[model samples]
Target: MTIVDTALHDSLRVLKLSGMLHTLDARLVQAQAGELGHLEFLQVLCHDEITRRETMSMQRRLRRARFEQTTTLEEFDFHASPKLPAAQIR
Candidate 1:
């Protein structure tokens, strides 16, 4: 009975070691993946200002087109088409 108990304990120890090694490897891989993803996020941030500026410029053009001399209702068809939005009513 004592021998059987000792064998069972040894098997459990081996299993524990295997599980720990697997978990450690997984953690290291995850850390590497996280670092790569962080780099991508930084690249996105670097271009964000440019993206914002272009968007604002486009918006300004749209705003200008909206308020640029349209006294007639047919000419001022804002929100009715993708080409024009936020135009004056009549």
Candidate 2:
């Protein structure tokens, strides 16, 4: 990374913009390749940060819920419990 890039990254880190920091390099590459305008580049960075934060929030919530395993109704073995009404589950 260049000196300017390093300085910018440090500033972002100090400001606690970790999501942006993580995606900065990739976004820069995309901007260069696509010739994105300044506003468009900023938009991409902000969008990535928002998405990263939302995904992190969901993972944290899931961890707090302490699920033994993830499963869907389709994966359930209805044959094992024929007496149970499968239609009600839907």
Off by over 4 Å in 2: 72-90
Best by TM-score: 2
lDDT at 11, model 1: 63
For model 2, how does the per-residue alpha-carbon lDDT over 1-90 read when each residue is reduced to its tens digit?
899999999998998788899999988998889877789999988888898889999999989999999768999888899998999986
lDDT at position 35, candidate 1: 51
- State every prediction's TM-score relative to the real structure: 0.30, 0.72
The lDDT of each candidate is 0.53, 0.90
Every candidate's CA RMSD:
20.5, 4.2
lDDT of 1: 0.53
